[model samples]
Target: MKYLLKGAGLALLLGTTAAYANDGLMAEIAKPEQWAIPTGDYANTRYSTLDQINRDNVKDLRVAWTFSTGVLRGHEGSPLVIGDIMYVHTPFPNNVMALDLNNDGKILWRYEPQQDPNVIAVMCCDTVNRGLSYADGMIILPQADTTVVALDAQTGEVKWSTKIGDPAIGETLTMATMPVKDKVMVGISGGEYGVRGRVTALNLADGSEAWKAYSTGPDDEMLVDPENTMVLGKPIGADSSLNSWEGDQWKIGGGSIWGWFSYDPDLNLMYYGTGNPSTWNPSQRPGDNKWSMTIMARDVDTGMAKWFYQMTPHDEWDYDGVNENILTNQEIDGVERKLLTHFDRNGLAYTMDRETGELLVAEKFDPAVNWTTGVDMDPNSETYGRPAVVAEYSTAQNGEDENTTGICPAALGTKDMQPAAYSPKTNTFYVPTNHVCMDYEPFRVAYTAGQPYVGATLSMYPAPDSHGGMGNFIAWDNVEGKIKWSLPEQFSVWSGALATAGDIVFYGTLEGYLKAIDADSGEELYKFKTPSGIIGNVMTYQHGGKQYIGILSGVGGWAGIGLAAGLTNPNEGLGAVGGYASLSDYTELGGQLTVFELPGEPAAN
Candidate 1:
């Protein structure tokens, strides 16, 4: 059961790493001059070592350039910059555009796929593409039409394309692909539509699918070597995932992998989380629903699962585990361990040993997380190895079908696809989060292909004592498992965060403001109003000898949908998941890429 990253795979990875070294890609990424990977680096820290745009001069930052995508939807991802070229992807029809960074952000080339128009209806949240990844001179994009395409990094021509999911049955692709070694890893989206989720690896050269492992089903389908799949130092045993479900529900059990991914080159394992089970009505499908609401560590080449840990067993609320798994090496209780930190949608934060799938620390990142009283990890304790569900919030299980009231953290849980940034310099994680709660009522839902499969009608509002705000930007200390500092916001912080070595952390607000705060003290330093609310990550790169920061501005995600569509149902607060109905008073809809630089710098080329 021992796995080694040897042979061609190792060589492919070494080639990438060496090429990265030769071209100084790693060094460039560290310099705040080039934003290489989507997650910044393989560690997925989203931390830049750039110091030029320090706190002292951040107020001098001004608009350098802007580009219009012309598609007014949620702009949920950041642009990828390689050398002098920057790549951007749009929603729905999924257009890929490359900008010449040296020529004042000129349009170099644009590739737009003729995707099925009907595909938009099946998307659970707002239509979002989480950005692209560049590897070995190719830009990898996961399209919403259930296909992954590799475009020529230089010319924007289609190199190779492979379909990974079936949109007809409610599967789509929104997460960005991760390029590891010679394989590009991608996952599907459709937990709400009852489509079984999966993660597949494609040969980076020709786009042929290498291997796929499902989030549900039998051990063979999941590539789960249960005898070797250690869950906290003990074997999970054969058919561990399959037996956890009732009947044949595992076929459509909904363990989607639609979030961010991280990797450890030395361990040769890719870490990703899976979404919740299908039919949010937990009573329909019983048992632990293993693999759903879980994180899995898998072999990069073969897609064999080494181990997994379920964050929520039989998720009653729609607490999807599809959050980013950030890889880092941190010390815990006096020993340095290869750690994977995840701020789950279930309102709990976990720090685990990525090498062995052992839980090291579990705590709440948000204080209002009341769905579960606590995550019990002590093996010998009576409430061992599961979340201690709070009876008041267990509406679905409490058999209150007529809209049970008062669920803290709402069905949105605590965070969404907007990922957190980890700064190695300050050893602090900057988390963008939601501070809303909900009232839920679950009804029976019959599955139908390409239709709304959700069984819940929930109304969300800002948590009580939340000071009338729906979001909080916080700095979390993972080693100590504590919140270092928090800044409350008028709306949910739907955008991703960027932490830099210069003691500044940047993020966008749902009200369309881009702000840079003191990374160590949580003091707002600089703020700029954009054309629309921001739902994208902040990426920084140096072009023409000037450091530049950029993010996409469009207000159409689940949090911003009410505002973008101009839905003003103040009393009900029903649509757009009922949480942000008041958003229209703050921002409107638009799609633009805004770039900023210091006032003195000659405009980027």
Candidate 2:
């Protein structure tokens, strides 16, 4: 009763305090100075309020500074620039480096950890570094071994390292973007293998335990109350087979929070999405897994869940909900409400109530999705594909293939490069999409740690619809929760999002181009190719009467690396890669951080 009263009182205070800033995103869209707040403000829109380089003068934008990460493998880490400093991470051994964003990219300090070379053998995705975190004068780096390490933001010194879960127990993962707040919001990997899945949080100040929430369980350790009030977690068990398979697969369930997480301060909620299950065979872990493939709402301080709405229940497809959950409010069905949205790898455009976790609207965000007709609320709907146990490919006649139905959006969805960011001012969401498909052929396998990490093997084929290249920049509508406008490109969008007050949405392409698009309409405003491939998130900010935009230039990961070889000759849309994985030829490039600003001497250019 005491917790409830306190929660209600805090809610009432926030409800009344945000009245003036209630301009949809304004209430949450962070300021440029608060670049410390990664994902552009708390809502994680990746949008900036500074307008130093608006559309009319963005043409004058030129290079301001560039920093290189030396280990050139996969450059997916989104740089975090807070106050006067910027933090970056690299793939091998996962090192953390801090530089002065205000300087000409001068190295302020470097903190390298004695990481294990063996951890490399465990990562399911590319050996890449997504990013780190900064809050309370400290930097939080979520390492490959499922450990969250804190560093002094001013001086690159280790503050504390909290090894939350074991990567050996299926925890090897990366940021692909960086960590936000000191919220040690970490999750497990090994979904391809038979590892358990879950996400947890720890205090950054002294590495104390804050909260933990698992991916699968009705008898979950965490329980939440709607209306933004109470949250407590305790292990609970319930039938998950109705959503996953026909039997008791939850016994070894696999839905992880391995993608990205966002926040909404006004609502005081932290949002994170979970990944898909292992085996790709639905029969293994049957039923709609609880937090997996769902965007969950939890209180930042206590780690209590407020509400959760599953996007894909019992997702037979390899559609892990490992995308960024961006926060933005919109008017829908003639009603104005707060919005929680994401571009799902499941090929779905998901929008829900940020506070209650109710499905406000869900649609097919992709052009080629054949998994299911659409989102069905019923538990017994046979529309949800069966497990791979019934597959004809299996030697056993009764065995089958449930996931990987050869949809247009393969494991890569309508949007895979990163999460689509929105600009409330323009009322549009900026997103990246790949035009590709895969014919999934599932085979039984096992998880023996150093052995083949996945329990099942899948052979991928090409899509019939995509005419070559990957990526289409779309200007989406938050109001209607639909595509406002779109333009196709040859390369996949591997970088993060950048929305500026200057009426431009900045992002990068796999073919090494940092481009800008008109925020209101889907039109290319400017494009510049970097040294090699571009797979980093782009950010914009200002210091001494100048505006600058920046992103990393290197390509790795399935989003960029796999496409490199298949892109040599160029067939249709910008050399869409077929199936080439290693990028030894470009490793020497050592990913450069290119910063652009208005022409000097005469500032305006």
Worst 10 residues of 2 by lDDT: 1-10
Measured by lDDT, the strongest candidate is 1
Q: Which stretches of candidate 1 lie over 4 Å from their true place?
A: 1-32, 565-577, 602-605
Query: Which pairs in model 1 have colliding backbones?
Result: 33-542
lDDT of candidate 1 over 69-104, digit per residue (tens)? 979878888998888888988876789899987787
| lDDT by residue (tens digit), candidate 2, 295-353 | 67777666666766566665655677778877665555455566677788877787666
lDDT of each: 0.82, 0.61
Whole-model lDDT for model 1 versus the true structure?
Answer: 0.82
Query: How does residue 132 of candidate 1 score in lDDT?
Result: 88
TM-score of each: 0.94, 0.83
